[model samples]
Target: MHAMNRRLSMFRSAVPLALLLVLLTAFHAAAERIQLDIASSGVRKLAVAVPSFANGSGNPNSAAGKDIARLVISGLEFHGFIQIVEGSTNGADYVVQGRYSSMGGQMMVEASLLDTAAGKTLPTRQFRGSAAQQDDLVLRLVDALVEDFTGEPGISRTSIAFVSDSTGSKEVYIADVLGRNVRQITRHNHLCVSPRFSIDGSKLAYSSYHRGNQNLYITDLNQNRTTKAISRREGMNLAPAFSPDGRTMIVTLSRDGSPDLYRMDMQGQILDRLTQGSGINVSPSFSPDGSQVAFVSDRSGKPQVYVMDIGSKRTRLLTLQGKENVEPSWSPKGDKIAYTSLTSGRYHIFTIPVGGGSPTRITSSYGDYESPTWSPDGKQIAFARKRNGQMELCIIHANGKGERTLFRLKGNQSYPRWSPRRN
Candidate 1:
């Protein structure tokens, strides 16, 4: 377990348009065909096509190639497995055909694909950057055609990390998954929140109060000022999950007074302690074979949603009907566990079955949704709702069906998290 020099340093949310086109038509209704099993099933769809996109640099009938083929058909119809067919390609099974160029100031784009049943022509991919990273060359040609028809790859290249007070404070930002550039990684002008990310997404830990100590930092998204802190001891160096192989991390320290859940690393040390003071153990996640850990406990009297098992430290009770469950997450194929329950007093989002079952409701509207997360290919989810008082950041489709609005910015945005699809 000897490691260091794992640097990173780049940190970078928004929502709104007809109520965001009725939430981008429920985020393009997710899938219609490609359910490789579960991440909440109900799949199928691949009509494809993309009609406009061919402007070797001029106006040869290319309004920026029909706006880069409507941003590659709205980012491969929001990654549920595509369906955007218009004008022709008869009943598509794929068509894509791209092109773009912009001299010296840089901007490449290529693309190709085709094969409406062996009319063949595969392998193509160009890309190039800097035209303000035109959505990073259409999310790398729509996540390289969804990793050439799903073998994996296409979280539109990935990036999320949230919490924004629109600059009056609550810093810590980062955006991308088609929500565009938007950086600003904690100027710590005060309150910063959760933020996780690291398992090859470079690094980004987070949990700040700026120096008054709510501590726990880590920033490095590749290098431009480096963040550090690691776990400034005191009363609570909160949130941090990481651990799918980027070394170790479970986090949620109360500096021994009680908050619980430890087992850190990647330099922040403290390698053990998995919950002890009896109650309050914050949001920790993991599982996908890190041996287990879902988190958010109230020790069994109230706050629910547990899991734990990291080497037999045993624990259970996973929200049996929620009288208030907290923020669980864990679902990059460890089967399920979404969380954020509550019920009549507001809050929504659910998901059960991580070897258990029951809880389903994935938010049916009415406002208050909480800090959910997931989506390093576990289909989708990125929460934080709130209503008339603002707060944004949304996305769905982990079988809660499509649902949209994931970009637009103003005075409120909360926890988010995402990141890890940058291979």
Candidate 2:
């Protein structure tokens, strides 16, 4: 009996030890990292090969297959982090291939990412939608592929809101990152500007002159597109910016005969006055932590950027070099603030550290850049550029490289506001 008891104790100890070993091995396998050098000059871009998707049904050279491949390539290249190259079987770090089929008015797509070094393909991801959703499905697949390669999802699903004059009047319009699904949000037919999204992206607030005054209004995007006036203070109600929590907004109101910043609830009830007659304070942007705000003020004789503490109400000047600075946008990472500065007779985009430092100019061209907006990941800046008497939308990397036109519309586009990352 003593020998039997000893054997039982030994077997129990060995079982736990074996289970631990299995768990450790599985963790190590799952934690393998993909080396992507996004910051190094040695490798400016990751070499990727995206061949034409194979058609599982219908014609082999179907337009649908070609369209899917084109969109996937465009979406990946738009981020400026990856370069889509040729030669699928050789000289590529990663390869993307997919198959598509259409049946009963529904389209299905299956795609896989291949690691050339490992000589293995990742598990296939499948998506199904109607024929009209072809572009959206390709965007989803590209986002997934980005995650597999960089461990961070791409911004293909995000959207941007801006003011355009396509309908012979300045109105707000929304479009995807790739400039598709363009929809006009307002049809005031007079003048509408400064379209700002709520933190949850379910609503948009702006000021319009259609009602014969600069009044503030909010539109419920999730509901049945109901629009309501939130503020009709009589002087100027413009540039509404939501806080990080979406409970309150900081807007420039001149109801009392002086333009100042006021924090108000969603119903336009004034919660507290942030700036008490501080020299035309406007364009408030909340920090990521909701502890501070960056805005533009002309209290010191010229327009300059300033940072203010919400708790103490202490303000500090941020831009010292530029004679005129406006439209301060706090970075999502809470480290920097991007704004527009006038230098050498032209408006340029510049970024300065949140804690006060020399501003670095991100735009150097002769065109005028204004109303800079940061992406959700804080990696890019979108702004309006005007040249040759035409205004258009442009984007530049945070590091000041890869400047390119974001979209080409019939009319001028200005005041771009990027949406937060979707679930």
Candidate 3:
């Protein structure tokens, strides 16, 4: 009996070590498979070639085929991790090709990724949708291709919410990441700003001044476009940020004659007062974890980014290099906070570590960039840039590369906020 007990104990001790070895081996394999190191400071975009897709009906020059290839290449290059080269070049690491066909108003597409050095092709992925959904189908395929190479999926289907004055008044609008399928969410005709989406992307909240006062409102995106006012306090109710769990929100309320940060439920019931009587605290952005929130405050005599512990309510300033910092946006990874900093009379996008460090300026052009919002994957930031007396939406990589205008619209657009990953 004693010998048997000793053997059982030894087995239990060895099992943990064996499991640890297996886990290490799996991690090493995954790291080797993905060649792109997203954290590296240097720009090392993977060289890839996306050839014109072929029509299965024997017409290689079909317009549908060309359209699909164009959309795929553009979507992949927008992420900043992959560079679409012309055809399969000498240094190209991978090649993407596909075939598409239309039948009975439905489109069928099949795409495959080829490993250049390995001289092999991955299994083909097939997609089917209405002919009008060709763009969406290609975007999904590019997302799948990205996931096949990297472990994480691309944000091809994500949308951006912003306040546009195209209709002669500031109203809320939503557009896809590629700037297609633009939809107006609010017809307030007055002024609407700070459009924020719930974590699940099913609801949107914004502050509108249409009813003669700045009031907070929520809209159910999944329902029949019902708009409900959640907070109509006497003073200002603006910049509502949904928590990570989507059950509560942190907003700036000035009902008591001073703009302060308050935690409130979805139904506009105040749960806890986060900040009171301090310098004007507004633009509250919750950390990825529900434990902390990064917001803009003027308590230090200048508007700067500050983070507070949700439980203890202890706050610490984050930006030190900028004179005035506002519109704090917490990254999805919870490592950095992106905000707009005033420099040389111009507002530019900058990011600072959550633990208090020197801010890193992201925009260097002759323009004013503001309202920085991190992508769902933490790889990019969408913001509003005013250049040459024109305001437009722009996106920049988290590492400060690949800065470009996101979309071209008729009128001015501002306060761009990226939605969370779709369900």
Candidate 4:
């Protein structure tokens, strides 16, 4: 683990007693509260079965079948209307089968989706790719099959932006959500992390250590026109939080040797310092209504989540049960905040009601899972999972079921923020 990852590991052991008390109280309150009983009805969940694909000419020990099937099923599972049937038993609403082929210096994959109930073919699609990436071609076809069943475009149309250092420099790269179209976004022979999209989705802001210092820079992604530095403070100008209205941002800076939260305009003008003397404040997340901010700080002890009223400067601790909590991402619906917690020496994503409640664990994998970012529709959470020394981005339904791997790039991928749907 890197130094930052190790710091997270230590936080799980250092939470305070007072916070634990608050968590117990909240749980009791929830148990006592009367809740409405709505009519019981369930959405028809389609079961999808993807059989292992035959590799035409590749390493027999490769992970092609599982990787492609996982990526495709993940996109369907995120929509919350489908369930991926594990194994090869073939008892499912739909079954997909595919094979790889190479011709004319290019690799091609052909796939077909069959309606198991009716025992007939429903849809078929073909994908072409570079001869070297034959497996990726199969995954893309799987995405198309998912779209045909759901009537909604699959995540294959979307791409993930992440940092990778396999080439010896930690630069940002954008790859298809299924791990195709792996294009380098930054060639700045420097370290770049925390890539975020602007409200319009045409610009990106990220922290870079390219100039021998940690600074914030914005790039017009469409035009490839780069802007001036947003912040170049002496220490740790990182974690930019864009406002919902798209006019301002809240960023963390450590210029004074203590990381504190600051609200800044889009043009890099400092608006106000919402926190002061709070121990190592970072990860500022604006509420859905844009009235308050949720952040992580080590003020009362170890890192814990705190919510601050934007106007009154009053603060309240949001997380009380966990020994360490960080990476708070407020839901777009404004009712809850999702974050990562270190419990039992493993990092997992959890969510608490913004009004206060027992934090619900969203992931229970044995690996270190952190950085929970909500989809714009507030129905899914994308996060980074470190399992077996390989780091990959995974998405789970906000309802706490249907976990699937979004993609597995060459290096560690973290800090996923979904873009709002464009008109």
Candidate 5:
């Protein structure tokens, strides 16, 4: 009996030792996978510094230099790829400084990127523009620095056009990625929805119900600033998507009483109907190669994602893990699709592969995240969420880290679209 009791005591000790080993191995594996995923997505941010830029226009310190610095800082923050350290902090990886030379009617600005520890300059560029063109100068310099660090063009110059109801009527407003230079693009006493950018970023096509019915209208941003109705069909014209070449648009129309996806030319002539009797298909997005289309459909008894071949008209379901998913936006790289899915009680943003895979949740604890729009580089996602009863624009890394608010507008903001890099 004594020997048996001793054996039992040893067994209990061995059991706990074995269990601890298993737990440690599992934890290590999880950490390894997380690191691998972050590296694969290139989502790790670099710590950099941007002190107050100096004025070189003989003023030594002017508001223009500060304004330029502020814009640059905002651009970097919005991109979410670099963390700007305070001037008081040290031991950073990189430091950026600037000198703004005011040229009377024009401004000449030079920005330099330096290695703080090594005390070496990484890259430098100078930009010149009229004083009235201050925004342009700052944007150009910022883009240069971005390319130096990330090897890709910055989104500072990219614009976002979305619907706003601040005027008591739904209208479209265009602003930079930093939410500055807000401009009212449309002032009609009508309702507009689904605003999209053309390939050249010179025109916007949206569905407006101002003329007693929903119709598609194109606003020319370059010439004459004119607006023309592109489609006056007998049914609801909405959800316009531009082709990669910008010569065609795939949209949803309910003229026949059922929402269906249709491909049309830039002139609104119907070229093909991609879906027929699909039970409310909408929000069609073309692939970057212009070979396939992804949209939302409820033919499966619930809203889910579907992709169709442009030529064969064959369809396949893309998302299976989520109960209901909608608002599919294909990334520019054509690798992933971002959409909103309801998990728990709040809506969260998720992304899945285009070829059908388990969806990865990107947002959590945020209030009703929706309408995720990918950046032109596919590195970050801009989305709208109602936090504290106010709609605001926020961005997060593609790998579900570095979540930050872009800015809070005066009124509610929704349906953000990040333009292609201008530089």
Candidate 6:
């Protein structure tokens, strides 16, 4: 056991986690305290008026204010829960009014949410940032306004990690939810895939073949992009899903001569062996509370999704309708699991209830969709679509609508993993 732990080392400190938890706790505590009926699930999209922000202060930067407003409108609309009304606030459910000022390379912006019928101004918050990082400031204000209305922060601040072969070799890359700021995370010059973000959004883990082995490695993205091999096992060290608290992860390791799921802590210490040498167990995803795990296995002569009780070590098959299923990603809400199913020789995205139900097809296009990953809010899914011998990362609403291309970069992109909302 000590040798096993030594083989799976890490490159991180404990200080950052403590600080992050404190900030996240405070953010949750200050969420929308006033109940709004329109924010409820299954409710109609709330009509909101988002006129141009006024220029108020030392420097008259009305263009900057308008730019911020435009981006915020696009961000809010992308969430699929807000309907922006252009002209009048008379028929709108709420109004977002704001002002911005810039002086000496710094920007200050404030915005307030107004309940039109109640004639009440909700919370007004001021965000400050350097002129160069104005996008961050604008997104912060956007999330604050979203929480003021929906009791949850908007996903505009989140990022998605994917594998691409742009450099003639598959490498991991990350980009904002808007598909801007595309940054390559790995330069292995060899195949690397299955990029997963820790629950805290501070760390990323993926497997690389640059060192002549498919070894698992983790990178502290919050740190100075330091990468470390947490598992250098002889064989498969594949996809890992972090637990909700970010302290532990369920990773597929084949060190014992057969691929199986193993529970390991952040420090690379094995906590428990979750699966015996089952028939090629892989692609494990943890439930929200960490009480269960959803994974793909071929124990019954075909690849299928199975849920395991973390306590009792008992497992149950979740998908029986598909000939082959792979890449089961549990929803952040803990109610559904999104995965890829091979149907009629074509791969597509599907979701099934956590309590056992028929799978609902989420993609019905001509392309083959694989590796379905959920957005932080569970409202959108990102997957890889293959058509015409080319592959690209694509996204769709949770209900199989609003499908759009997410990336049009140089090469075939696959194995998308959505990150949590940034701090």
Q: Relative to the true structure, how large is the alpha-carbon lDDT of every model?
A: 0.74, 0.78, 0.79, 0.71, 0.74, 0.78
Q: Model 2 off-target regions past 4 Å?
A: 1-42, 57-61, 86-90, 102-107, 128-132, 222-226
Tens-digit lDDT track for model 3 on 269-386? 9999999888677788888989999887767776667899999999887888766667788899999988877676677888888888677898888887888889998989998898
- TM-score ranking of the models: 2, 3, 5, 6, 4, 1
Q: How many backbone clashes does candidate 3 have?
A: 0
Better structure of 1 and 5 per TM-score: 5
Better of 4 and 5 by TM-score: 5
Query: What is the model-wide C-alpha lDDT for candidate 2?
Result: 0.78
Q: What tens-digit string does per-residue lDDT give for candidate 1 at 82-117?
A: 678898879987788888887778889887777667
Superposed on all Cα atoms, the candidates' RMSDs to the truth, in angstroms, are 17.2, 17.7, 14.6, 10.2, 14.1, 8.6
lDDT of 6 at 306: 95
Predicted candidate 4 versus true structure: per-residue lDDT over 170-216, tens digit per residue = 77776655566676777788977777778777778888878898788
Q: Residue pairs in steric clash, candidate 3?
A: none
Candidate 5: segments with Cα more than 4 A from true spot: 1-45, 57-60, 223-226
Error of 4 at 103 (Å): 26
Residues 1-423 of candidate 2 have per-residue lDDT tens digits of 453334224222211000001222322222232222344435447678887788875443677787788899889898887778864557776788788987788888878977677677777878889977777787888887766665567888888989899889988888888998898888889778788889988888877889898888888876626478889998788858899988998988888876788999988899999998666777889999999998877788767789999889999998899656778899998999998877766778999999998889999877878888999978889998999888998998887777899999998998888988776
Which candidate number maximizes lDDT? 3
Candidate 6: how many backbone clashes? 1
lDDT of 1 at 68: 80
Which pairs of residues collide in model 4? none
Q: Write the per-residue lDDT of candidate 6 for residues 246-324, one digit (tens) a residue.
A: 8899887778876788999886678999898677777888999999999877788767789999999999999999666
Q: lDDT tens digits, residues 1-423, model 5?
A: 453334224222211000001223213333343335445555345567776678764453577666777788877767655667865438556677788876569888788877665566755688888988888888888887776665556678888887777888878888888767888887778977667888888888777777787788888976625467888887777748889988898887777877688899988899988889767777787899999988877788666788999999999999876555677889998999998775665668999988987899989765878778888888889888887888787888798887778766677877777776664
TM-score of 2: 0.87
Clashes of each: 23, 0, 0, 0, 1, 1
